[model samples]
Target: MNSRYLTPLTIMSLAWLSACTPTRVSNQVSIDSPAQWQHAANAQSAETADLKTWWQGFNDPLLNELIDKALAANHDLKIATARVREANAMVTGAEAALYPSLDFSLSGGREKRIDRIVGVPSGQGIKLITPTADAVSGGLAARWEIDLFGGRHLEAEAAAAQAEGSQEGLHAAQVGLLAQVATNYLELRGVQQRTGILQRNIELQRERLRTLQVFLKAGLANEADMVRQQTLLQSTEATLPVLTNAKQNLIHRLGVLLGEPPENLENRLAGVGPLPKATPTMPNLLPSDLLVQRPDLRLAQSEVSAAAASLGSARADLYPKLVVSASGGVGALAVGGFPSLAESVYALGSGLSAPIFNAGRIRAHIAAADARLDQVAANYELTFLLALEDVENAFVAHRSARDRFSQLTEAEGSAEKAYRLVDAMYQRGAGDYLVVLDAQRSKLAVSDERAKAETAVSVAMVSLYRAFGGGWTIHSGIDKASIR
Candidate 1:
C-alpha cells in the first residue's frame, strides 16, 4: 500500500471506532428547572417584552451618559474584553490543528578548501587547491495530524465554547459596572438632596434661635428656653459637614467610574442639580428571562458546555492518532572539476500512535473531565438560582421603598403644614416653644426619610436591571457588536 494511503485508512478506522461508542454522560443538567421558580399568586408579573435597552427606561440623560463612559473605560471591563480576545485567539489556534501545516525553505552556500593527499602515493607531499563550490537547495514540507479519534474537533469545540464564555464574561463585567455607576450616582444625589434639606433646616433653626434669644431679652421667654433652642440649632448644624463630605466621596467614586481624575468631576458637578428622580414604575423582569438575559448565568452555561467538550476530548485520547507527512526538495552539488550534478527527492509518510499503557492516566483524565463538567453544571444551576433570588429581593425592595416613599411624601406635606401652624401659634403665645421645636424635628426627619426612600427605589431598580442582565445587546445584526 502507498504510504500516502495509510494515514487516511487509519483515520477512517479510528473514526469508525469512535462512532461505535459515543462517549457521553447523561447527567447534564437543564438550563432551567421550572420547579425552582414557582410563581406566587400575588407576585407581580414580570414584563414579557425584551429589555435589551433597559437603561433607557430610566429616562435620565446623565445616567445614560455615565453608563456609556463606564462601558468605554472601566478597567475591569477592559480586562474582561482582553480575556475574550485571548479566548478567540485560542479557538483559532485549536482549529488550525485540523488542517495540514506546510512550510518551505530555500538556501544557497559556497565553500573552498585546500586538498591534502595522505594515502595516495602519487599525490603525496603535494598541496592541491580546490575551486570554490556553490550549492542551492529548496524544499517544501507538509504535516497533518489526522483527527481520526475526534480529539482535534473536540479541542476546537471546547476552545470555541470558552471563547463564547469569555465574551459573556465581558458582558457580565459591563453589566456590573453599569449597576455600580447607577447605584453610586443615585447615592450621590440622595446625599446631595439630604444635604440641601439639612442646610435649609439649619438656617431655619438659626432663625428660631435668634427669635428665642430676642424673646428671652424681652422677658417673653426664660434663659433656659433660649439655651434649649441653641442646643437644638447646634445639633442640626453639626450634620451638614458630614453629609457634605459623603457627597464629595461619592463624586470621587463617580469620577473613577468615568475614567477621570476625582478632582476633575468636582468642578463639573459643583453646580449640578440633585440626582434625577426615580423612574415612575419599576421594571418587572420575569424569572424565566434571567436565563437569556443575565451575562453571568450565560457565562456559567458556556463553561458547562466547554467542560462537556473537554470530556469528549479526553475520551478521544484513548484512541490512536493518525498523521500524514510529505517532503520534497532539490539540491545541486559540484565535485572537483567535473560538471555540476543536481538531484531531487520527494517523500511521503504516515504514522499511528496509541497510548497502550500509562498507568490508567487516560481513564483518570476522562474522570477528571467528567468531574469538572459536574462542577460547572452545579455552578450553572447555582448561578441561576442566585439570579432568581436577586430578582425576588429586588422586587420586594422596590415595592417596599415605593410604598415608603409615598408615605414619607404624605408625612412631609403634613409636617410642613403643622410647622407653619405651630409657628403661628407660638408667635401669638398660644403654643409653647416645645411644640415649634417638635414640629421642626418632625419635618427634618420626614425630609431625610423621603430622600432615603427615593435612593432605595433607584438602587433597587439597578439591582433588578443587573439581575436581568441588561445593557449588553445591540440591535445591529453583527454578532460581535452584541458582545460587550
Candidate 2:
C-alpha cells in the first residue's frame, strides 16, 4: 500500500467511525389516570388487609389450602415458568454475540504425486519421478464483531426485556389460577348451602303432606289439598339432584386445577361447608398503582421495551460493521524418509462491510421494526385501560354483591319468622293450608338467594385481587423448579 493513498483511506475510515452516532428508542410511557377510583367512593370504611393473601380474608381454611396446592402444582403455571427460563437463555445468547468466539481445529493428511518425463534420450526411453509427503496442521482461530453502533448491545437489551415480559406472564398465570380456585371453591360451598335449604324444605313439605292426609281421613281436609301438598314435596325433591351434580362438577374442576384427577377431591370436599364471606372494605389502591401491581400491565410495558430495543437494533443494521479475526497454528511436513519439519504460523485480519446497495433491504427492516414498536406501544396503552376497567368493574361487583347479601339476609330472617307464625296457626287449625304453603315457599326462596349472594361476593373478591395482581408477591420465589 502507498502512503499517499493510505493517508486518505485512513482519514475516511476515521470519519466513518466518528459519524457512527448511537441511536436508542424512547422507553418512557405516560398514561392518563384519574386521581381516585370512581367506584371506590362508596366502599365500606374498614381496615384494609394485605392483598397478597386476600383469599385468607374469607376465613376459609379449606379454600386457603386448595389455593396453596394449586399454586404449586398447576400445569399452566409450570408452562409459563418454562417460558421465562427460555427467554432468560435467549438473553444470554444475545449477549454472547457481542463477545469474541474461539475455535480449535486439527487435521492430518497424506498426499502423493507422480510425474513422467517422456522426451528423454532415446536410449532411456522414459524417466519417471515420484514424490510423497505427510502433513499435519493444528490451529486456534478467533473472531469478534466490534459493536460500532451498539447494535449487539441493543439485541441483548431486547432479549432482556423479553425475559422480563415472560416473568410477568408467569405472574399473570399465578394470579389467574388463584382466582379460578377461589371462585370454584366458593361456588361449591354455595351449592351445598342451596342443597341443604332444598332438603329442609322437602322435609317440611313431607310433614305438611302427612298432616293433610290425616285431616282428609278425618274429613277435615279435602283429598285434592293433600294431593297438592304431595306434588310440592316431589317438586322440591327434584331440584336436589341438580345441586348435587353441580357440586360434584365443581369438585372435579378444583381437583384438575390442583393437578389431580377429577375424583381425587370428592371425598375431601364431601362434607357440606358454609359459604365464604368477603370483607366489606376494599383494598386501598390508586389507579396509577396498577402500573406496578398488575402483571398484565407490567407485561405490556415490557413488550414495549423489547420492541423499542428491537427497533434500535434494526436501525443499527444500516451502519457499517467491523470484524476482527485472528488465527495461530503449527504445521508439520515429512517427505519420504526425511525428518519431519515443523513451522509456526499466525495471522490477523479485519473486515468492514457497509450496505452500499441492497435495494432498500436495510431500510425495510427499520420500517418493520418501527411499525412493531408502534403496535406494542398501542397494546401497552390498551392494557392499562383494560386494567382500569377491571378494577372499576370489580369494585362495583363486590359492593353490589355485599349489599345484596345483607338485604337478603334480612329478608330471609323475616320469611323464617312468617313461616313459623303460619305453621303455629295451622297447627291450631286457625290458618289456611294454602297460606302455610306460601309461607314455606317464600322462606326457601329467600334462603337460596342469600346463599347465591354470598358466593357472588366471594367470587367478586377474587376478581378484585386478580385485577390488583395479588398472590404474585407472596409467590415471588415460585419457579419451575420450585413448583416441581
Best by lDDT: 2
RMSD of each: 4.6, 5.9
lDDT of 1 by residue, 159-221 (tens): 998998899888888877888888888888788888888887887788778888888788888
Local distance difference test, candidate 2? 0.83
Give the per-residue lDDT digits (tens) of candidate 2, residues 14-61.
545534538678866667766788988733322223666888888878
lDDT over C-alpha atoms for residue 367 of model 1: 95
lDDT of each: 0.77, 0.83
TM-score, candidate number 1: 0.86
Assess the local accuracy of residue 17 in candidate 2 as a C-alpha lDDT between 0 and 100. 55
- Global CA lDDT computed for model 1: 0.77
Candidate 1, position 333, lDDT: 85
